[model samples]
Structure formats: C-alpha cells, structure tokens
Target: MASCKQVESMIQAWIDGELGDSERVILDQHFQECPLCTITLRKQQRCAALLFEGFADHRLRHSIRQRVMENLPEMEPLRVDLEGVNWRGHDTKPKRAWLGPLMRMAAVFILICLASLLYSAWPKGEKNFDGAVGMITQTEGAAFRETGHGLFCRSVALKDFVKFGAFYKTGPNSHLMVSLRGPTQLRIDENTRFQICDDRKIRVETGRVALDVSRDERKFRVLTPSGTITVYGTVFEVSVDSVQTLVTLQSGALQVESAGAQGELKPGEQTCFTRGQNAITTRTVDTAQVLGWTKAIMPDSEAYDRFAREVQPLKIAELPGEQVFAVITTKNGKPRAVSSFCLAWNPATDGEERCGYDVHVYNEAMHELFSVHVDGSVFANPNRRSHEIDAPGAPIVNAGVLHVKIVPDNSAGKQTPLKVSAVGL
Candidate 1:
C-alpha cells in the first residue's frame, strides 16, 4: 500500500498520531507486511515514549523556550531535516536522534538562570512590626514605663517594641534611644518623659530629645509645650522647659508653629516658643552653639597647634613656632567664651590690613556662633588684653563651652607662610 521510502518518511508522524486517517491506513497496511519498516516503527515508538516520560512537564518546556527567546538577541531562523543526523549536516544520525539529548541538556542550564531571574523579580513582603511601632535600640540608666496598671521600672533589651500612648521616662543620668522601621533614630536625653503617638510622631511632656532622620518622603513631627515642629529628613535638637520650647536645626529643614503663627527653618536656624501671646521668634543661629553637646574634647594647646600649622607660613613671634596665643574662657569647666587670637605680620598701610588672623568662636555645642578678624596693625598696645582691642563685631562672651580657631592671613603677600609668631592679641 505504501512504498518503502514513504514508510520511512511517515513512520515518526504515524507514531505521533499526526497522520491523517487515509495516510495512517496506508502506513498500517505497509507495516503489517514489511518487516524492515515494522522494526523502524517500533524503535520510533520507544524513543517517543522515553522522551515524553523524561520531559513531561509542559510548563517547564514552555518556560525554557520563552526564556531563550526573551534573553537572547534576534537571530536568523534555522530549519533542520527531521530525518538528518544533525542540524546543517548530513552526517547526523539516521533520525537526528542527538537533537533531543542536546535540547534536554540546554534546558537544564536555562532553567537555572530563569529560576534565579524570577526569584529576584519577586516582591518582598511588607515589613512587620507586630502591633507596636518602634523598638529601643540602646539605653543607659534606669528607664521607666507607665501602663494602665501602674508605673514600673524594668530592664529591657534592644528591639523591644514601643507602642502608641506608651509613656516612657528616664531616671537621673539615664538615657534611652529608639529605632523605627522607617529608619528613624531618636535619642531620649536624661530625665525625659515622652508619649509615642505613632511611628513618626512624638509628644515631649518634658526634657529634651535629638532626632537623626534619614532621607525619606515620610514626615516626622514633635509636639512641645508651646509649639510643634514637622521634621523632614534632618538632624535636629528639641528642648522643652516649663516656660518655653527651643528648636535647633543642625541640618536640613523643618516647619515651626507656635502662638497661632508659623515659620520655616533651614539649616543653621533656630526657633523659640514661649508660653505667651506673640512669643515666637525664628532666626539664624550658630550650629556649634546649639549642638554643643557633641563637642570634641581637644585640648587648648592641641587646638592652637592644629590651627597654627593649618595657617602656617605666617608665624606668631610671641608664642612657639607651632603655638598661637589661644585663650579659652570657660564657665563651670565648659568653654563659655574666647579672646581674639591675633597675629600681626601683615602691615596695615594705605588703609588696608593684609596679614592677621581670622578667628572663629564656637560654643560648647562646637557650633561657630560668630567670627571676627582682628586687624594686625590695629592692636598697637602689646600689653593690652584681647577684650581691650576694639575689633569690630567681636562675639560676646556667653555661658557655655568655648572653642577658638585662628587661621593666619598673608593673602597680600605671595600667600606664603611667615615662620614667626608676629603678635598675640
């Protein structure tokens, strides 16, 4: 019914059930009588059964093809003779039997890469806080908690959740620090009691707190006795006394509202709210003065030597080559005020002073509150004290830590250092 050549070509299709009824009938009739073709058909059936059993996952096959198509660049389509030994080569086996094994091996590697890609693209679930908002990251001294039952002092570990309306207080010499899921850090200072409203809001009933907020779109807020502040990704300090509330922005920005009036603050700005009508004021402040709590503990001599070398070439003849006459006035052992450390090498001739010192005065917070440049030729009396010199716009002495840095000026000269101690004011 069918020729040997036709039987050879149609055997695979017949085994796969892809032959039409007439073609199948002809193939069946030929196979019943032809021993050679019957053996070939049996081999084809075995091969098909093995392939289907080995790679039966339909989705896996689809994924492999999809991944290869999507990730690789476009290429020309390739056609292979089903009966050939190999692609593009007549040397392929009689039925191209190597194709199935080659594709199977390739599928293994592709599946690994595709699995990795899919896993990476998958979304991570939302962060869990249980029911509370934040946890205590660090604590020093005794911290107390007020609950519906009663007030109790307890030992807590890091990562203990702080819930809404929970009142937390610190004993003397005690401090508490909190970290939140939003990546916010709050340092609760000594003798402080505050109630948490939410993850981003706090009410300070008393004492002080420092906030270091990471850059984020979410807004943080603080409520004080006399005013409120809305925080926006910045470092700042807030102090609430019985009579007033003080806010200092070391970096970033905030909005202050008090006494029915509102004001905006940028970096190096401060605002004060007193408990009275029309008692709100905002102004530029010295960052070091307000943030004096973070002062570096460098000695006066080291500070002077450091600045001296930094302003080198201009020498102070009154002191050692590496030393400058830098005096720090303190209140209760904290730097409270500073005297102008003057250097007199650049002569003031023709109504211009060339060589001298640029003095920066900082408070205990290590904030440069103000600066003054003492004219080198202006201080005629070497015996005159620093305060006697009438330097314009000199900073007033205040109660707090004081730090001074003097930078030598030889701008009028070839900008070289004068290796001498010119004079001290």
Candidate 2:
C-alpha cells in the first residue's frame, strides 16, 4: 500500500490511466483504508469531470499553473486545515465562492496575451519588433489548437511564466529569435532541441542558441552536452552535437564547468570540448560573424561585386549616422575604392612621418575590420592630392566597406575620427 506522501504526485497520473497495473493496485488498496485519500480522489474526479465537460485542456492547466506561479509569489501564503477539508463524510464547501469570476478574468487575460502575440508576429506593413518587453521566440510554421496528442512547434513563449517550459525543437530553416525573461533576447539556429529546465536554468541538447542575458543577482545557467555556463549577465552562445560542445562569450562574465574542471570566460573568448572529454582550450573569436545573426541585417558582402570593386571618387563630406551607409555609399560613390570627399586637405602640421594617421575599416554593422596608418612620408610629393588609402592585408581596398571609424597612427591616445566622406563598395 502506498503512503500519503507517495500518492500525492501519482494521483493525477492514476486518474489519467498513465499508471501501470502494479501502481494502480497499490494505490487502490491504500485508498480503501485511507479516508483522506479516498475523499481527495473523489473530489479530483469530480473536478476533472466538470473541467472536461466545460473548458479544460492540458495547455489550460499549464497556463493556470503558470499564472498562479507568477502571481502567487506576490501573495501571502495562505494557511488551511488540510485534514478537516479532506476528511470523510464532510461536505467540502468553500468559505468564499468568488472563484467563478476569478476564473473568468484569468481566461480573459490569457486570451489577450495570445491576441497580442498574434498581432505582433503577423506582418503589419512593418514588423512590430519594438523594444522587447517580453519574449516568445518561435519557429516558422504552427498549427493552433492541438488536434491530437502531439504539439509540433518550437517557439519562444511564456517568459518568466513561473513554471518550466518543456523541450522545444526546431526543424530545418528554423532561424528564429530567442526571447527569454531578463527580458533577454536571442535567436537559435535550425534543428535545435532545448528545454527550460527551471526558472534559472536552460539546457541546449543539440544545435546552437545565443542569449543576451540581463544582469541580475540570480545565477542563471546554460547547459550543453559539453559543459555548463554559469552566467552573471552576459551575451554568449552554446552549441551541442555528437562530437563536441562549444561555448562563446561575447560580453559579460560567465564560468564554464566541464568534466571535473571549470574556468571563467572573458568576453571575446571561445572554448570547446570533445564529448566525454575533459580538456578545455580557449581561443579568441570574431563575434561579428559568429554572432551576426543577432544583428539587424547580415554583414556587408557587396564590396566584392565586380562593379562595386572598382575605385572612384567619393567626393563627399561629413558622416551619415543611423542610416545604412552601404545604401548611401553605393548610390553616390564608386565601388571597391575609398576616396576622400575632396581631392585633398593640407594638414595644420606639414605632414609628419607616419602620416600620424591610420584609418580603421568597418562593415555596415560597425564591426572594425582593419586599421591603416599611412606614413605621410611615403609619398614624395609632400601633398596628398587624392588621399586613396589602400587596405592593408586586404585586397578589397575600400570598395564596399561600410565606413571608416578611425584612422590613427601609433598615437591612438591622440586619435581622431577618420574624415573620409564615403567608402564605395
């Protein structure tokens, strides 16, 4: 016979016939001698029948629990007489009967949240991708209202919803945003399986997911097949597969725990571990490519196009902020070549050695690519008529780069912003 403590969790499974024969036999015998158990079972059956007869679903139960969890924390814990309530031959009547209206309000609230997500996800001339108040990142296709026992979709839903989110899977072409509470936002690549283990922990079983976790006192965790990342508010990524596990930290601080060993990760650091192995080695990473998916748009590759590769005069002045410099540069300047807006400008200092200037190149996303510091002493003529700086270590020249941020020689302490009008691609 099962004890009271043992039967608490099994009651629902037994009611749903999810228990095996041995388990059922044990529970049945115990209930015969236990009035509390028997009474509780009867009430459960009545509630289940009433619920099924009216408006009840697995999702609804989950929704209710989540709502309760979120709001329950704000409420004072209530004390009730458990033994008297479930005793035999007692009419279990509640003291207050305001439950009906509370249920109605909760249902209304759930509906409003669903409607909000639908409106936000549906394209309305422009994406309502505004400030992320909360997150519900999901995959491409969806079938609403589960018809059968299966729910086939992967999405970002129910952030800070007070309960664990079940395992979610994404199929091919499943590049979708990863929204979490922290009100953190991230995106997962395709063919990924992950689960929210708890309020403070998530596990990525396979494939890649990146998150920008908000800084907080709580210790959130991202677990992978290789190791676990204990975060203290950071942007990072984890990937899992048969052979290896990879973790990349973009910013913030985190600790990676591997096989019997752990190490803290610094920003721009990457670490990978082989399956069932302990060795951990870290290397520097170029996050512009690894974390590019998080960007508003892809990195600029137009600089390589034939026409875009040619060099011509940009002949412009000043800088364009916020606007896509790529679009503006393509329209006004020749591709693949970087030229000053004007033919030349004489410096206040009569051309010091090393030009005392070098230019830093960036893609449209403002990721610094390379810096070029020219020795003004290179040109014999003393005056720089057409200041066409060649891209050091890069064959592309300045054709289709986003823009120049800074060009400083060894004297970065006295560095000034590059005054190039436009860089053509």
Candidate 3:
C-alpha cells in the first residue's frame, strides 16, 4: 500500500484519466479502502472542473479570441465556384457553359484581394535597438520597434511577438513586459547586447529580463545580467532586479543556475540568486501573479481625454433670460476679437410671434467683422429661444480674447438690456 502523500499525488492524475494502468490499479485499490484519499480525489476532480469552466469563460474576452484567430491561418477561406452546371446526362445552355469558369475567376480575384487586406493589417515587426528584440504580427498596423531598459508599456497588438530588450540602469525601476505569440526563449548576458535570434535562441548582454514563457514547444531562454537561463517547455516568469535574479515556474518544469548552484523548479516553484552567490532557495509563489506582466492591461489616455473633452461646455455666452447660450473659444488658450453677432429667436408664447434682432460684435481695435440678427422678441415674461449667427472667418483668426455685444431692438427702446453673461470652455 502506498503512503497518503503518494496517493494524494496520483489522485489528480487518476481523476484526469492520465494515469497508466499500473498506477491506476494501485490508486483504485487504495481508494477502495482509504476514505481520506477517496474524498481528496473527489474534491480535486471538482476543482479541476471549476478551473476548466473559468478558463472557458476567460477565453471569450476579445483579446484572447483575437489572438486565437490570428494564429489559425488554416481558417482562411477557400475560393470556390458555385455556378457550374452538371452536363453528365443533359445538354447545358451556352450562358451556363461559361458561368462555372466565370464564377471561379471571380472567387479567385476576391480571395487575392482579401489576402492582401489581411496582410496589410498584420502587426509590424519591431527591431530591438539595445538589449534584445522580437517580432509580432496581426492582420493590421505597421511593424513596431521596442527597446527595454526598465518596465515599458506596449499596445496589445505588439504583445504577440514576445520581442523584448533590457539594458543596465543604476536605478531601481528597470523592467519591461515583452508580449509573446507563443512560448519564447530569452538570454541575458553580463554587460552584453543580444537579440532574440529567431524563436529558439535568446542572445543577451549584461542585463536580464523577466520572461513569462508559454507552454508551446517554442524554445525559451535568457542571457542574464550575470548568466544564462535554459528552460524546458513550460510557463514561467523570470526577472533580474539589479544584482539579484529570480525565476518562477508557474507550470511544467524548468532548470535554473548561476555560478554552478543548479536547481530544478517544478510547478509553483521559484528560485532567486545574487551575483557571486551559489546558494539557491526554492519557494512557492503564485504563478499567475508572477506572469501577470504578460497579461497586464495598459491604461488608455486617448479614450479618457475624449470623454473629458466632450463633457465640458464650450466657452460661449448665454443671454440672461434665455435657457441656452452660444460660446466661442480658441483651440488653445488664446482669444480673438468678435466683430459681428446674429441671433434667431423662438417665442415661448406663440410660434408665429417670433422676431429677429441684429447685433454687431467688435474687437478692441473697433474693427467690424460681420453682423446678423436674433429673430425673436422678448417681453416682460421670460421667452426661451435659440438663433444661429454667421460671420466672416477673418475676425476669429487669433482665437483667444474675443468679445461679443448684442445690439438691442431699436423698436423696443434702448432700456431693454440684453441679459448676457460669459462662460469659459
């Protein structure tokens, strides 16, 4: 009979249907008698099921779906003809005779156009200027170039190529996240410079980069700030913080060593080192947290700015008793002279009683730009209305510092002051 620890180790494999027959027999016999092992196996099975369910849900995010689709070149549509008529037993019309070939030609042309569009849309490759570099592609955008000194932010589309680089910085903040399309290998050299040579070998100079390697057969390696990292296929995160270096294996297995103190790290295992030290300590770390850099979300400034810009009111002035106002401001902070003004108004009491008012806008120089009128009337009662004003473009040239004045209706006596106040954008 196996010990409890040994049984527990094999239980997950058994539930997953991954154990060999001999291992299965041993587990089955033990489960029949050991209530603890049986319960443990059942619990593990449930956990596996839940984990898979969560994974399925996560795969639905747009980023994951886009990546999956990009990798599946086989899904590209094939061209085919649909207009061919069968002539096995009967005669076909002359128009039908040419239809099959015509359709085929059309399909070919469409396929060629589609392929060209997709190729143009693919992500552009990046050249590493320093420590290291890699290439990434999608169906859009030009190739991107990236260099690593410390931590860097990249567009999600650039993440697929796993191209990254790092250089020695005396300060503490040197880190970078290199996106990967598949499992990648990187090498760091002590005071050296190198590039990701294909997807198999990583050339490095005297700096190190943390790697979040995927599970694909793509070879992953790193030239370190001090030495080299050779890895078997696995998912792991590696980092070199100054004189110290660390490698954390989240899944599968990996080998790490510096100055000949070598250690094999299994899933959930991590190793750390300092220069000239042979001591290697193995500890457990959360794999997801360590590799979180690979999947980190970047902040979007443009979208945030757009929202902020649209929410604020433009700097136009409103009439005192009116519900709405018109504003004018320069693109920057500068102000210009307003030489003319026009207002078309609506009467609150009746639609037919509306009238127009002509107002002149002038600059400090007393130059006239153009003029128009407000087409509504104001009585003692508050009447809400709006009007459009047209002016020559010349007066608004220097955008900042412009002033507007409303000319009262001569028929209503100058006593009626157009209630007005200025607002800033």
TM-score of each: 0.38, 0.36, 0.29
Task: Give the winner by TM-score.
Answer: 1
- If ranked by TM-score, best first, what sequence of candidates would result? 1, 2, 3
After superposition, candidate 3 runs with Cα above 4 Å error: 1-134, 137-194, 203-219, 297-425
User: Residue 33, candidate 1: how far off, in angstroms?
Assistant: 99
For model 2, residues 1-425, the per-residue Cα lDDT tens digits are: 45687776678877998766666777788788899988889999998998887764444533477667877546654443333323443454574367878999999999999997676554322222322222333334321211123343323332212124556566676455544444455566777777766545788888888888765434577887777777746888888897778888998766666665556677899998865554557899997688876564221233112112221111112232211112123333334544343213443344434334545556544576666555544332444434665555534443343444333344322222223455344
TM-score of 3: 0.29
C-alpha lDDT (0 to 100) for residue 56 of candidate 3: 97
Give per-residue CA lDDT, model 1, range 142-179, as digits (tens).
77666544443444434456677778887788777766
lDDT of 2 at 216: 41
TM-score of 2: 0.36
Off by over 4 Å in 2: 1-134, 137-163, 296-425
Error of 1 at 330 (Å): 43
Clash count, predicted structure 2:
20
